[model samples]
Structure formats: structure tokens, C-alpha cells
Target: MTKSVGALTVRTDPTLKEVVVDGKDMSVYVFAKDTKPGVSSCDGECATQWPPVPAADAEAAKGLNQELLGSITRADGTAQLTLAGKPLYYFAKDTMPGDVKGQGVNDTWYASAPDGWKAGVKRQALGVLDHPKLGKILQDKNGRTLYLFTKDEPWR
Candidate 1:
């Protein structure tokens, strides 16, 4: 179950916790072109497609971190909820609770993480690459190579 803190909430994904708005499966997004931190660049037509996440009531936060939660005043003077200074938004096509249609739209928009981080797609390796010093290196299904640093500790 997702833990609700006022109008905002947190949902667990495989790698990290995601922010959900309005207690629904709606995943919030951040625009890459939003040059101004703590302010939303999406407005007018853009705002119609990506609706801003409304701020939670002043006294209502359940499991969300208070420090990372905040609000920003939009051009229309409406207050919208912000996480880690990034304004949150919802996708239009996500009609269901668990829809992630907005995960990586336009390479500019992405699902918002609880820590105000952006999630990346996980790729599977199909073959290996011949490295000069590293020898044979693992490559993803798309030919992207990956590396394991010697300084990294083993997973427990």
C-alpha cells in the first residue's frame, strides 16, 4: 500500500520510491525545460496536458518527508505542490491508478522519485564487448556496454 501524507504519497518501485498525487496511481512528472528551480515552466497548453500536482493541506502529511515538501505559486496565482524544489505534474493519458505512460516522454519529461530524482530504464545485456584493458565487457540488448568498478563492494 502507498503511504499518504496529505495530498501527496509515496509508492515503492523496484529500485526506488515514487511520488503519487491525489492518492491515486497517478505518477508525477518533471519537465526538463523547467529552467527555474521551484517554479513550473508548463503552462497554457502544456499545463493542459501535464496538470500540476496540487499542494497538500498545511496540517496533513502522513509518511512524506516534510523537508522535501513545498509549494510554488503558478502564473495564475494557484499554489502547486513541490518536491525537492521541482514542481510536480500529472500525465493526461494515465487514466488508471498504475499507469506510467509518462515515464520517459520526449526525453524531457519523466516520472518523479520521492527524493526528487529521475528514474531511468533498465536494460538487459545480450552479449559482450572486447575492451582493450577491461577485456570482455557486458553489453545490453541494445549494444550499450556496462562496467563493474573494482572499488565497489559486493552485494550482501
Candidate 2:
């Protein structure tokens, strides 16, 4: 019998927003320690807990960018799938398809976004607040709304 190919896709989780998942809907993750593109730092015991997604026969799902999908040779000489240059992994504790127990683990592991960013991570350092008149506005970390003074001259 011919083996079926697996696919990678994006799904919206209540806590993780949009996360990249494997063909089985299992959440995929990235390691912050993996600072280099096309390389992986997760090995040995680390690999046992967070298994790398094999590159063989893996494809991007419909509506997903196929260009972002690639592969890298691991230390063991095996092929591991990569997204936007970052290696992908499966959390051992995530027994079910939608289990994201691996998110924020040790602050080093995170669910991957479609664009290969850490899913659910705040992109900006600023915060957001609801305004009665303006509807919504950006705020500082201290809860102060930010505004620009048009009359103020630009610094030289």
C-alpha cells in the first residue's frame, strides 16, 4: 500500500490564536534557542520531549504558503521540516490534536504562527485600551494612552 503524505496547516486556538499544526491537527512548536536558520538546537533528551517533524513527504496545506515550508538536516543526518527557516516540533505532552500544553513552556518553546512567529506572543511592547470616543487607542505598558502633539516641532 502507498503511504499517505502529511500536511501542515494553520488553526485558531482559543489561547494561541492562529497556530501551525501538523496533518493530525497536533500543535507545532519552535525553540527560541534555535537562533540560526536551517538549524535545530533541540537534541538528545530535548528531542525526546519535543520530537522534530520529519521533512519527508510533508506539504503545506491549502491556503498556506508553500514557499515557507522547507527542511534541514539534523545532527543525526535525518531530515526535519522547517517553517520560515525555523525547525518544527511536536510536544510530547500534547496527546490530542488541539492540546497546546507546550505553549510558553520554560518561555523557550512556543506554538508557531503561520508566518513562523511565536503564536500568541504580543508583537508590540505597547498595550491597547478601549476609548469611549475614539473606540480604541494604543497605550503604554503603564496604562497611559499615547498621543502625538502636532504642534511640537521635530527634533533636529
lDDT of model 1, residue 87: 79
**Model 1 collision count:** 2
Each model's C-alpha lDDT? 0.66, 0.81
Candidate 2 collision pairs: none
Candidate 2 lDDT by residue in tens digits, 59-126: 99954568768889999998888876788888999998889999999999999987666888877668
Candidate 1 structure quality by residue, lDDT tens digits, 1-156: 212325556566655345444565567777788868557899999988998877756222454555666789998887887766777788899888767788778888877755454645433446554332344657665445566789988994
Quote model 1's TM-score.
0.65
lDDT of 1: 0.66
Best by TM-score: 2
Model 2 scores a C-alpha lDDT of 0.81
- Positional deviation of residue 79's Cα in model 1 after best superposition, in angstroms: 0.5
**Model 1 root-mean-square deviation:** 10.9
Candidate 2 residue spans exceeding 4 A from truth: 1-5, 125-156
Cα misplacement distance, residue 28 of candidate 1 (Å): 1.1
